[model samples]
Each structure stands twice: as structure tokens, then as C-alpha cells.
Target: METIAFFNLKGGVGKTTSAVNIAWHAANEGIPTLLWDLDPQGAASWLLDSKAKSKAQPKKILNGKTPIGNLVKPTNYQHLDIIPADFSIRDLEQQLQLQSEQGQRNLIAKLIEPFSENYALIILDCPPSFSLLSEQIFDTADALYLPLIPTHLSLRTFEQTRDFFKKNKLKPKRLHAFFTMVDRRRSLHRLMLAHPPKMLKNGLPTPIPYAAVVERMGDHQAPLPAFDRNAHVSKAYASLWQDIKATLSDF
Candidate 1:
């Protein structure tokens, strides 16, 4: 299965929202998608209306004490399943740091290997950080999707992330970014959307607009399309999903 992660070092950039929407779109297309909520906050899990059947420690899956498959819970959507995260996931970073470099890198890949036979795609909803867990995600995911807001500070963070990958000798081609929370009323946002930096020229063309509906995801506890498919924000996400599908085809 192809694994993709939605991540950003900076939070509040629509990372989890984008991951949830894309996974829902993939499942709607009958791709048999699995979304693993790796963030300790469990936002994606709650958004999808998925809950752990038992109060099992998520770290058990990491140490092999529990079968990863046992944690998989079907979401309200068809062809979509989720492995919800809880506070226990916060302990994984310390555990990963204790392993050798190779072990740290391969730990996540090994844990998700069994799902390949069932899922065509696995989406990881990652936390906002630069730690050993993030390193494992970088090594395990086939592609990493970054959500950026159209602002000077956001671009600065993007540059820092790019430098991190370069310094670490990670494959830069695996990184793909897109614009989020874009407000055309602001001249800077309009300018960036019209002519992004050369590095971001490769980003997905469709930008998710700043909308109340997008923010209401918590109130709805469902994907945009599920609650208001006709909303412009919902359509934007649909278009973004198409762009992502075409982009992943290359890999």
C-alpha cells in the first residue's frame, strides 16, 4: 500500500483536516483507505466519529505487545477505517529515541506492513513537531503532504523544513505542499496565490479558502463534503483531492 502523511512543524495549518478530507475522498473512490491518527490530540479520530473500542494503550502497538490490526476501527464511512490515537501515543517519541537509527526508521513501516494486504492507501495524521517520531514518519511515508498558509511566516517555516530535509539527505521529491486558509481579500494572500515562490510552484494549484464551514468541522464532526457538499470549501477540497490523486500517480 502507498503511505502518505499530512504534516507540518507549525500547527493550525489544516494538516489534520486535509488528511481527513483526502482519506475520505480516497475511500469514496473505493480505494480502501486507512487513516491512522498519530496525533495525541486525536482530532482526526473525533472528526471521523471513530473511537477506540477499548482503552488500549496505543504504545502497545509500537512495542509489539498488541497487534496493530486489533486497533483498526471502521469509521462511519464505507471503505474507510481508522486507528484512533489517545494520550498514550505521547510516549512513543521517548520509545523511538531509544532505538538505533535504522530501528527508529523502520519501526513505523514494520507496524503498518500487515495492512498493505487490505488497504490500497494509508494516511497518517501527524502531530506538529520535529522529533524522532517525525523522522520515522519521514522514512515510512511514500509521500509527505504539507499544508501551508499563504503568509511570510509560513514560507519561513517551509524553508526551515526544506533545509532540514537537505541537511539530513532525505529525498526532497517526496515533499509536496499546498496552500490553505487563503483569503483573497488580503493583498499578500492574493499575490502569493497568483505567483508563489519558485519552490512552491510545484504545490497543488487548488487553494482551500478561509471559510466558516471549514472551521465548523469540529461542530459537524465529519468531513466538509459529508455535511455540506455544496459549500465552496467542500468543492475546493474535492479539487485538491483530484490534484493529490494525480500527483501520487507519479510515485
Candidate 2:
């Protein structure tokens, strides 16, 4: 299975929303998709209307006491399943550190390996932080999608992420960034969208516009397409999914 992770060191950039909508699009196309909510906040889980059976589930899975597959729950949409997360996932870093001194770093990769037989695509909705868990995600995912707002601070964060990868000898090419919450009324946003920096020349082409409909995902408890397929933000997400699929094809 091809694993894709939605991550950003900075939060509130539509990371979970993109992950959920993209997974929905893939599932709608008849591809078997699994979305694993790795964020402790459980926003993705909430959006999908899936919740963990118990608060201890994440810790148990991390400690190898519980089979990850057992926690997989089918979503309302066909061909889509989710491994929901809870607040307990916040302890993931601590659990990984206590596992094996040498192999702990690759624990996530090991955990995700067995799912290849069941899923065609696996999406990980990662937490917004640079921690041991983030390192494991970097090593495990085939591609990392970084969603950032069109702002100077967000650009700086993207550069910092690239530098971190380069300094650690990881493949920076794995990163594919796109703009989120873009408001054309703002000159800075418009300028960046029109002509991004050299580093973002290879970034995804579609930029998600700022819209109240996007925020309504929480109220609908579903993906953008499920609620309003013709909405501008929903259309943008559909186009973004197409771009992502084409990009992943090159890999």
C-alpha cells in the first residue's frame, strides 16, 4: 500500500480537513483507503464520526498489546475505514521511547507494514509538533503533505521543515506543500499565490480558498463533498485530490 501523511509542524492549516476530504475522494473512486488519525486532539476522528472504544486504545496499540487492525472501524462511506485516535495518543512519544532502544524509531513503519494486503492507500493525519512521533511518521510515510497558510511565518516553518530533513539526511523531495485558507483579498496572499518562492515552485498547483463551508465540516461531521459537492471549497478539494493522485503516480 502507498502511505501518505498530512503533517505540519504548525497547526490550524487545514491538515486534518485535507486528509479527510482526500480520503473520501479516494474511497469514492472505489480505492480501499484507511485513514489513521494520529493526532491526539481527535479532530479527524470527529470529522469522520468515528471514535475509539476506549481511551487506552492508543497506548495499547503503541505498546504492542493491542492489534491495530482490531481497532479499524468502517466509516459511513464505502471502501473507507478509520483507526480513530483519542487524547491518550498524546503519550505516543513516551511509549515509543520505552519500547526498544534501537528499533523504537521505526516502530510506526513496522506497525503499518501489515496493512499493505488490505488497503490500497493509507493516510495518516499527524499531530502538529516536532517530536519523536513526528520522526517516526517521516520515516514511515511514502509522501508527506504539508498544508500551510499563505503567510510569512508559515513559509518560514516550511523552510525549517526542509532544512530539518536535509540536516538529517532524509529525502526533502518527499515533502509536497500546498496553500490553505488563502484569501485573495489579502495582497500578501494573492502575491504568494500568484508567484510562490523558488522552493515552492514544485508545490501543488491548487490552493484551497478561505470559506465558511470548509468550517462546516465539523457541523456536518463529514467530508466537504459529502455535504456540499458544488461548493467552491469542495471543488478546490476535488481538484487538489486529482493533483495529489497525479503527483503520487510519479513516485
Q: TM-score for all predictions? A: 0.95, 0.94
lDDT of 1 by residue, 1-251 (tens): 79999989999899999999999899998999999999988999999988876767667767788888888999989999998885365577666766554544467788889998899899999999988778888888888889999998998888887778888888877788899999999999999998899887557889999998887888989998898999998999999989888778632
Alpha-carbon lDDT of model 2:
0.88
Cα deviation of 101, candidate 2, in Å: 2.3
TM-score result, candidate 2: 0.94
Q: Report residue 35 deviation for candidate 2 (angstroms).
A: 0.6
In candidate 1, which residue ranges exceed 4 Å CA deviation? 101-105
The best candidate in terms of lDDT: 2
lDDT of 1 at 81: 95
- Candidate 2, residue 170: the lDDT equals 86
Per residue, candidate 2 scores C-alpha lDDT tens digits across 61-90 of 766787778778899999999989853654
Residue pairs in collision within model 2: none
